[model samples]
Target: MDEKVVRYKKNSNDIHVLPPSPYTEVPKPNVRREKLSVENEETIQTKKKLEKTKKNFLFDPRRKTFLGRSSLNWARLAAFYTVFYFCLGMFFVILLYVFALILDREVPTYYNKDSTMAVRTTATVVGMGFRPQPMVDDSLIRVSNDLYEQKRIASSLRLYRDVYLIQKTDAKAEPCTELDPASELVPGTACSFSWFDIVSTQDHPCSDNNMYGFKHEEPCVLVKLNKVYGWTPTKGPLPIHIQGLRNIHNNKSIAKPDVYITCDGTNPSDRDAQTEMVYYSLEKPSGSSKYGVIPNYYFPYRNARDHVQPFVLVQFKNLPLHRLISITCRAWSPGIEHETRGMRGMVAFQLYRSQVAEKLIKDDN
Candidate 1:
């Protein structure tokens, strides 16, 4: 050994005292593992570089998209919604068309079922009504030539004349007579009501010119019947107390059947007032009838166009004044129902006068 020192070993030979090897085996380079690690580091760097780029939100240039969704994807979503809403709207439109087909045009689907008419299946008949009321709910007529109340009544009557008396349609109407009462109603035609003859007495008796009889101590009241669809009163005899035109003795009068109307006081003193009544628009007797009347041709009102429901003008010559007076009017016909509780087929109004019109009461005494 070349300069070898002898050492006492504790367990084995010391590495510092060991001799170097002459030919050590050289280690092989790890090419596969190094290449794999390099490739992995490159992929990580490339991913980080892509993340740094600003993908435009307005137009994604790399993917040819908008707001991250491709144009084809957006088109598919829009098409789906478009067809969905269109079908929904058309479904409702068809339903509404079907509903419209079941409705009636001229005839009403429902009618008034008031028991007052006595006929339950039919519509309610119109009741009698009046005008010149200061208020609609008020049941009294108070007017005078001297008091300012007459102006209101006059304006109201004028308004009534203009509005309700209007000829709504020009439909051809048939001229009717008592013998041909059925002629008043043709299946397809209207009836002609005499409009000019309503106030055409010997002299404009119950017209607005005489202050409607208020100045002469005679107050005029307008009475009109309510319209009911196709309502015709039955042909019947008159009641015993309802004198109608029976008391009048006129041989020249024609015989015309009619629906009679009468008015009287409910109290005994009211009946004793010596009241004289003149009726305008009373049909001139023209047949086998004995009294003036509302001709039958006016009935079975079909609500025809060009139809103006006629009204009766009553001129009270000696109506009591300065006191509350009660008056009741009734229309008598077999088909008409009279119900006091319902005010059907009848009208009641109170008369109160104390001023200018009352002087007539004094003159008679």
Candidate 2:
């Protein structure tokens, strides 16, 4: 007998049709039912989102869109950024020109202490600097009597001295004393180094031959006047008390210099132990008893091309060993401003020495 059967069509749902007779064979359906959907709402949503993103990233040739933006929109953005950066660049260039206009090539905009404002703790008044500084940002003078250290120090002193000795001044320059009125001191007049020759002075403890007195534990410290442009010192007589400390008898008739450089111990004990303190200068050699002087003639420094700053060489002797001695060296003049807090118009540092073996400080090298 004939039987009714169900058949599946791809698009339509279900149909009842005649099955194959004994004359023809039909394969059994492996799938029980059509796969309505194995994927859930989440999977469909994810696929939809990915397709949307791909469409946004793809170039739309029909719409003339690039990087997901319409050509017109892209043009607007490019124009905006170009104008923005161009204006920014122009503003920067204008600021640079303004700064250049305010600045001078000859002189600094802010000089002296003002140049260091918000950058340093040093006082506004000029302060001296020390050389042969082994450590940075430190003012300690730890000059041990060790032979090796002494030799290194002595070489350093000679190099420092020779810097001025070997210096060649401008041929156009003349003597500073010969400067006429309205002298800007350009390429300043030369001062003969021979007249100021502590470095080459014979037999002096401050001389390089004696290793600047560091050979015998009698360390010498060089003090230089802090340079202040256009400063003119008012010459005056050295105080009697300062002269007494210097162990020098001044002939009152001879005029004294304005800047009297004096170094003494800070405390009573240190002062008493300071036993032997002497002074020498490259400019005026007053027998090591008088205070070091920077003559008024060296004033009104104009930042010349060949200007040599005056320095004072101080030799210390009879100091106690293996102890720290606080020393304050100051430039005293009638009008020079000094601060109680800052070492203004002055410089301070501690001196310490260690015991050393007896060795000849002078070597052929």
Candidate 3:
């Protein structure tokens, strides 16, 4: 009933009318998101307030929420595992320290398997007249452990040398290993000693046995040296040869030298002492005995000089001089402490004076 005039427009709503076009002008809805940064301290405080409110609503313990219980269990498990791992690591560290201590004491003192012996020997040689050279195998040229050792021969007839050995026990199975004094081996492994004199006369002269004593007097000889020395073995036996006192060849008269005898050959005073060469006469037992008395020169110092030195020759004679046996010789040296070095030379004799004379005449000598 009221006066209404219709206006021409593209789109017209009875109450609100506008032109119909692709572009429409209306207030855009605001979409806001919060950001926090160090540049503005107020942003951090606002963010904290929002986080607190959301956390309280979502994770209230008194509300008995299943999500809250799951999160708490996860936290408790993580803490327990962290503490367990820490304790386990501490236990291992303590164990390793104890093991190292045990090995340090036992190895160098009790067993003769110390590698430092080699080091000390090397040092001593350098200090003296000799020079040290590293040993090396052709195949192991690039490896660190491969080395060669060489020294010049001494001018003196008596020489001293050091022997070295490397020992190892691997309880932890480390590929790189050293001696473990704390550990005991079932059979024990040892390194071979490679030091000796080029002029050594005994086949297999070992200082350890020379000082101690020969197990079998099969070819017995002893040398009581001033200082201890080591020997090396070649092939089945040592290349060294030992010559007996009876076999000593000299152009001098039949008169014997002033001989001294001592079980303690290493003692300088005793080293110069010599045994009395006593001749014993044997009598025939009226042609009744099958075995005749054979002349024997008894040298009683075979065992005493094995370890301790200055072994003296005890020369005593037995009858029946036809059968020739074995001959052995020993040496004594000068040093502060007396110790046996080793047997130096030996000879197996089966020659007759008559045979020697025939050969000499035949050769026109």
TM-score top scorer: 2
Best by lDDT: 2
Clashing pairs in 2: 196-282
lDDT of 2 at 96: 99
lDDT of each: 0.65, 0.66, 0.27
* C-alpha-based local distance difference test score of model 3: 0.27
The better candidate by TM-score, 1 or 2, is 2
Q: How well is each residue in 77-194 modelled by candidate 3, as lDDT tens digits?
A: 8899999999999999999999887764322342112334344232111000111112221111011111110011111112333322111233221111124211222222222112
Model 1 per-residue lDDT tens digits across residues 1-365: 33433456688666345444556554679999999999999999998777645455657788888876799999998999999999999999999898789875544455445444537424356588876576778888775545456656767766776676645455566666665664446664565664345665424655667656665657777777787765666554454434435764433423343566677775787777637766665464111122225676766666466667767766666556677778887776555667788788888898876674468646644
Q: What TM-score against the true fold does each predicted structure earn?
A: 0.60, 0.63, 0.18
Candidate 3: regions farther than 4 A off? 1-69, 105-365
Candidate 2, 147-256: lDDT as tens digits:
68888877876776667434464433445442442144444454443324555555777666677788777877888777676555544455565567666576453343
Better of 2 and 3 by TM-score: 2
